[model samples]
Target: MIAIGGSAGSLPVLAELLEQLPASIDCTMMIIVHRLKNVPSDLDRLLSLKAPIIEPEDKQPVLSHRIYLAPQNYHLLIEDEGTFALDYAEPLHYSRPSIDVSFASVAEVYGPRALAILLSGASKDGAAGMQRIIAAGGTGFVQDPASALFDTMPLAALELCPEAQAMSLTDMVHFLTELKMSAEHDQ
Candidate 1:
């Protein structure tokens, strides 16, 4: 699995990443972006231009090669059984669909094979989760602070996970494009 989390300045980053990604990749991509509880995911619709995707619901079975968007008001968790479990627990970082919750689950589920990326945000929501990913032997990356409109989130993640690659928008796009190609080639 490839898990990504972002907040304040995340929409454009997510869109650009999606646009560069191949129509199909070998693994699932799950995104948790901080959003208001009642707001519907218009971003999900916008991103469908690139690949098959869904705003996951409770008990939904996870599918490889799909993009899953975390819903508002609920923290999306990856169950050990390869299903999704939505939680309404108190928000971490003052937001539901907490990035840390989602990323940590991905780390636990996929371990060394997981790839976790933290993008632009206003808070440190994903920092600890990035730490968890690295500690679990998964690869970690963060958007370059210079490329982020709001640098705090990425900066925080860099501090916690110093081994994470700091990627600019263009660098990240190129990396993921090549990664998908390599994974497909290996398969």
Candidate 2:
């Protein structure tokens, strides 16, 4: 499983990633982007142009080769039974669909099999979750602070999990390409 957390200045970065990704991958990808309460988002539609993306429904099974976007106003969570669960809990870091909540849950469920990427944002929401992921033996990656449009989020994540590789956007694209190739080869 792969979980990507982002806020502020992250849409363009995500767009770039999706634009460069392979047509298919062997794992499920969950995208957690901080969004305003009650505001409608076209993120899923926008990204679907580049890949098979959707705002998942509660209890929907987590399936490979699809990208799941966290819907606005609710925290998107992964269940132990490999399904999705939406939460109406209080916001974290002043954001619902909190990146931290999603990351933490993914780490707990997927452990070493999980891969997390923290991107540009103005808040510290993803730092502790990245730390938890690392502690649980998952791989974590942070956008290079210097290149991020909003560096705060990446910097915070790096501070907590210095071991998380900090990569430029270009490098991240290449890394993901390689990952996809490897997965295909294994099959």
Off by over 4 Å in 1: none
Off by over 4 Å in 2: none
lDDT tens readout by residue for model 2, 1-187: 8899999999899888878777776788999998777766787888786776889899999887789999898899999999999998999999998989999999999999888999999999889988888899999999899989999999999888988999988988888889888877887
lDDT of 1 at 72: 81
Q: lDDT of each prediction vs. the true structure?
A: 0.89, 0.89
Clashing pairs in model 1, backbone N/Cα/C closer than 3 A: none
What is the alpha-carbon lDDT for the whole of candidate 2? 0.89
- Cand. 2 TM to true fold: 0.96
Query: What lDDT is reached at residue 95 by model 1?
Result: 88
What is the lDDT for 8 in model 1? 96
Model 2 Cα shift for residue 66 (angstroms): 0.9
Candidate 1 per-residue lDDT over residues 105-139, each given as its tens digit: 98899899888888999999999998998899998
